[model samples]
Target: MNNVKSLNKWANAHTYLPVDLLRMALGVFLFMKGVYFFSNIQYLVDLLTPIDKIDRIGAGMFLIHYIAPAHLIGGILIFFGLLTRWAIISQLPILICAIIINFMGQMHHQNLLLAILTLAVCIFFLIYGSGKNSADYFFKMQK
Candidate 1:
């Protein structure tokens, strides 16, 4: 699509080291969150219990299954800057739901802040794409 091309061009022209570091940090943070969630399944279940109450379709169960794996894979893709936008796209819904759950679920201050921060970083990368130091740029150059 024209929009994707334009976005790529814009991102390519604006690559910076700070942005790249931020991207890597975001990736590591996400990966760690995934590991934490996977290891502490009961913690996640307890957090989502309230949302499950609102929806009788057992969507929370599905989310419990989906979130950890998505974060793990998406985090790796993002760290390597491979298919950057798509990786971010996969994470968008999860991040949005995280923010919402923080409000409607356990209401933990630290969790809410972290979710907000991660969501903000994700939105930035969704728009910025991977930078010149990324696998995306390397592959683009190969082509």
Candidate 2:
């Protein structure tokens, strides 16, 4: 009886806010990228122009895999509050490079906005974390 009560207490306490907020924010960014991909493939192609010299076909294929799917998966993980820290860590490099690309390409204000927002949120997740509301907690629970 006491064990049941303790378990219930743990479950009740599982509900928290920070993780939800991060999840929502991450979802928005991911959704935005998918929208952007479908709407402005040409713009992305232009932004990715630098890689063209390496191998045009390969660059296109790489972008299709790297840029499009990553956002989708990242968003999903965040939405489900699973592996969120790892998700953020995985996403940081792409986003940071995007910011660099935009700055170099002189893209514009909006181009920088998502990058900045993603970087800020990822940094927060890296620090304070999502507490017990993530797969990160599951791993820690084992230890």
Candidate 3:
């Protein structure tokens, strides 16, 4: 589409080293979180309990299965800046649920702050797209 091409053009023009570093850091953080969740699924269960309560269709189980893989794979894709927008879009729902669970279940300042920060960064990347330092750009240039 015209809008996507324009956005991509803008992102390519505005690439910065610090932003790439931040994006990589976010990728590592999410990957670690995914690993943590995979090892300690009970935490996810506890977090998603409120969702289960709100809906009786065993949605929590589905979410429990969905989150770890999404984070792991999405994190890697984000780190490489390959399909960055799609990766970010996949992460958006998980981050939203993370923010929502804080209030619905137990309120923890650390978690609340982290969720907000991650969500904000995800939104930024969603709008900004991947930059020149990314695999996406490298491959695009190859074309």
TM-score of 2: 0.69
**Model 3 agreement with the true structure over 86-109: per-residue lDDT tens digits:** 999999999998898889876888
Judge candidate 1 against the unseen true structure and give its global Cα lDDT, from 0 to 1.
0.86
Candidate 2 vs candidate 3, TM-score winner = 3
RMSD of each: 1.5, 7.2, 1.3
List ranges where model 2 is wrong by over 4 Å. Answer: 1-19, 38-40, 50-57, 133-143
TM-score for each predicted model, relative to the true structure: 0.92, 0.69, 0.94
Per-residue CA lDDT of model 2 for 48-135, tens digit only, reads 6655453545657576567766777877776665776677777887888888878666676886886798788777655555455556
Q: Give per-candidate clash totals.
A: 0, 0, 0
Clashing pairs in 2: none
Question: Tens-digit lDDT track for model 1 on 28-139?
Answer: 8888888999999998887777675635776777888888988898889889898888988889898888788888766889878888888889998988889888999998
Give the lowest summed-lDDT range of ten residues in model 3: 50-59
- Strongest candidate by lDDT: 3
Top TM-score model:
3
